[model samples]
Target: MNPTATALRAGVRRGVIELRQSLTNGADLWNHAFWPVLMLVVTYFLRDVSFGRTGFTVGALALPGILGMNAAMAMVTMSQLLTADREDGTLLRAKATPNGMLGYLVGKIVHVSGGLVVDLAIFLVPGLFLVPGLVTGSPDAWLTLAWVLALGMVAALPVGAVLGSVFSSARAQGLLMLPILGMIAISGIFYPVTALPGWVQWVAQVFPVYWLGLGMRSALLPDAAAAVEIGESWRHLETVGVLTAWAVLGLVLAPIVLRRMARRESGSSVARRREKSLQRAGM
Candidate 1:
């Protein structure tokens, strides 16, 4: 079999193993259920609020945002796990074997994709039955949302992987997540982007979060927004352009970053880090 195919197979196998372990350990349930459930409750309560009489329908707007949230969570959790594997010397041990790196990456993708599947399932169940606004929208809107969610995953996963490889300490997870969380806040995940300040809107244009939100809004929001007297054209176009640019950049950059991180990770170094982590935990 070709290297890509072989690597993908290995990735699938590893992902299954990791997922099973997560299930046993309770991580899978928490990640799959926790946030979505919270969001659902919040959305249900806030259903009365109106965005210009269109209504603040969580099912219509929030689902896409939650999907984006899913991407973020998958990326962060998988990256952190990869970081732990690196610190524990699993990656270092794999490096000596043929097609190891390929398999390793494959596994990471598989694991994250699995998590995304769970997240989507949670979001969709409510979206189909409970979201009143979604019921009234075009079928095309849902299709657009599907594409945006997939592409958003592509955009976020690489960046997260790169961050995991670069950030050696667990403490850095908090540091790394802060900026991303800030972006999510501004991306109109819970509210309207148009309500945000101009400078904040401009800042959002630079990242994948904004594009994901824009693409999602295009799917969910009414056509009147698009036909507005004046506004959002440059903002929307910039989002598409920036996200596409980042996707390309991530593809080129991820491998390079991973390779460098791999080169720096030796068994002894990993063991030392693991020991340090354990020591810090008083374990």
Candidate 2:
């Protein structure tokens, strides 16, 4: 078998093992449950809130967009985990092995992506029961959901990886969270993009979060809901085009950035980072 193939196989096995471990761990299990439950509660409250005279519940409208926002969050997860792994010398260890970097990347992708799917299902399953307006029985709805999610992940994860490679410390990485939150606020994750001003709408559209939310809303919402959107259509072509552009940019940047970050890693650097972490904890 090809060496790359073997590495990929090894990575997949490692990822599956880690995911299983996470499922069994108490803290991880809590993390898996908490967000879905909280979001479901929020959704329940919003189910009655009306969106102007459109005859749609504001809650029902927000659900799919929330799903999209959650999907977009896979980027944040990737960046944080990558930063942690790098700080702890995991990246350096992978750099030392043959195709270990590739294997390592494959493992992280598998782990994060698998976790994301589980999280989505958790949120989506209970959400369907709470909100009645969604097109749950339609095959097209589910299909569109799958493609948007899969593509959205593809577009978002690489950018997360690139962000991870850029930030050398956890402190520096933490700073990224605020801006991301701001972006989420501006993105159409919890509300309609068209409700915002024209310039704000354009700004939101530039980010994947907006497109991802739009795509999910397209999937689960009724045809009439498109009236709340910019073009009064799903604009599936624009969705695909924008997401593809992001995916390409991220894929191109991630490897180059990872390679550069990896070259700078050494035993001493890892030790220094660990020492600083320990000192901070002591303080």
Candidate 3:
């Protein structure tokens, strides 16, 4: 009956609608399936290849890291969607309604996070079949997968919202992909971090991508795989510590940044942006 509660419920419904649209729309469905299908194809070819004499196939080792990297990428999805919504005047329309920003943000989170879960399932289900050496039968493995996913989303999404707030245009948001791709390269998604240069390893560790990959590896890989990791251990404590730190930092900063960005939204501003986009497209 309360106003905020009503807004929250509306946000949930909006998120569910958007998610259903994503499933039903051809373009959205293709977007969801493309990456997972490509990854599966790559994994299939690598299934027989050894990873650094570990007796483990490259596909087996890369599978969990891929899962983590995809989870962390939820941030990019959130950021890009926010940029698109703003450009299209969706944020301005929300600004006109009571507690609309709150509802919009909550809806965005639900949609983005929900999409991430679906994408992960798409990859992991077939991945388990394609990759060997995964501890899929253990209760502990599933538990680790659960917590890592939850934490990874919490850690990444807020930061993504913040990044979305910072970029004013879709062009700028597209530029973000370069840095993200660079981070993935250094984050041990396709290989071990221990194999990278010392400075690159440190750089990768500073971001959530590496920690997410490491956490995934810790969860699914066997004990012997730890020998190939830095410090020759899973380092669960460090993973938690680093990811928690990022989650706290992002949570603390996102509200401030989003509020500032939202304050700048207006009917005139949205109209001007739309006009400019139309002009650019014509040019």
Winner by TM-score: 2
Candidates 1 and 2 compared by lDDT, better number = 2
lDDT of 1 by residue, 1-283 (tens): 6977887788789988976776667766886788778877776665655566643453456555565666656668767877877877788877876778878887788778777777677866776565565532578878877777777777777877888888887766778788878988887667766678879877876777767766766766666544321263424455556766776777788999999998898877877888888899999
State the C-alpha lDDT per candidate: 0.71, 0.91, 0.91
Query: What is the lDDT, from 0 to 100, of the residue 19 in candidate 2?
Result: 86
- Residues 51-162, candidate 3: write the lDDT tens digits: 7778888888888999999999999999999999999999988878998988998899889988988998999998888788888888998899899999999999999999
Q: Which segments of model 1 are wrong by more than 4 Å?
A: 1-4, 20-25, 52-60, 135-139, 225-240
| Model 2, span 37-138: residue lDDT tens | 898899899999999999898888899999999999999889988999999999999999999989998898999999989888999998998897998789
TM-score-sorted candidate list, best first: 2, 3, 1
Q: RMSD for each model, in Å, please?
A: 2.9, 0.9, 1.1
Error of 2 at 81 (Å): 0.8
TM-score of each: 0.87, 0.98, 0.97
Question: Which has the higher lDDT value, candidate number 2 or candidate number 3?
Answer: 2
Clash totals for all models, in order?
A: 1, 0, 0
Model 2 regions lying over 4 Å from their true place: none
